[model samples]
Target: MAHRLLVCRIWTLSAKEIRCLPASSTAIASTSFSTSLQPSSSQVSFLSPSHGLPRSFTHTTRRQVSFNVQDNEDFTERVINSQLPVLIDFHAQWCGPCKILGPRLEKAVAKQKGRVAMAKVDIDDHTDLAIEYGVSAVPTVIAMRGGDVVDHFVGIKDDDELDSFVSKVIGK
Candidate 1:
């Protein structure tokens, strides 16, 4: 059914999203299966930045996109409902700090995949949410537990600080 395919697509997307994190690459070769993948026809071709080499995707066709506006939508379900603590990156596309914040967010999310759920919002897209949350600035990073706003920081914080905060709040 179409619904099943969409669920599959979403899961595949989630996997690809996870692999995009920086740490996963270093762990790839030790798996021992890296040398055995036969080149397949379904792969899409692209260039690799790290090695300055050409590469092909055996899967994935992620169109350019961003997270949708969420309003009157139960963010509690989206966040607290996760089996893990949740980190929501309140961002607008045009904010400069937001640009700098992404890689770090990705790194954190990668490091805590099963332990945390990461969601992003575009303030421009969700004016209601922006107003409701009193998010007058971009790049506000908030951490939530049990569907409630426990604490948050604006702009960038060192990894150690973030790690410690997560540990304290999530009881890790």
Candidate 2:
């Protein structure tokens, strides 16, 4: 005879959480979490009527958000454990400060895509990661090198400051 374990989590304004099968994987979850689980759409249009292409052909470059990943269990083997330096952003969607910081963080990753890997941990879900890093607040940003935390930028960060900080750490 064999034994199996299962877990499930559901939250307000989110779909049901069901753990099925022989438990190859398990997720630890709590009630106070919301997930934007929709299939990611690749089209984002930013067009105005006056300065757009006629009345139909309106489109903006749809940019995808990618965070570098490594295998630091706080992240994932594919993420925090990468050979290249990694930047991890610990954020919660419900946090107001996160909304303001998201774009800048994305831009930073975009500029340093190949050289650096970016990983984002949703604190609400990855409480294990947050605790591991001692993240007491949302929007905590960290730079990890060779699996250890090298530097961190908490609260809102300035682009100029971030660029210099990353370069210094990377010894660029």
Compared with the true structure, the alpha-carbon lDDT of candidate 1 equals 0.61
| Model 2 whole-model lDDT (C-alpha atoms) | 0.62
Reference-based TM-score of each model = 0.55, 0.57
lDDT per residue, candidate 2, 131-168, as tens digits?
98899998888888887888887898788877776676
- For model 2, state the Cα shift of residue 130 in Å: 0.3
Instruction: Give the Cα lDDT of each candidate.
Output: 0.61, 0.62
lDDT of 2 at 167: 72
Per-residue lDDT of 52 in model 2? 28
Best by TM-score: 2
Kindly give the stretch of ten consecutive residues in candidate 1 with the minimal lDDT sum: 41-50
Q: Report the error of model 2 at residue 77, Å.
A: 0.6
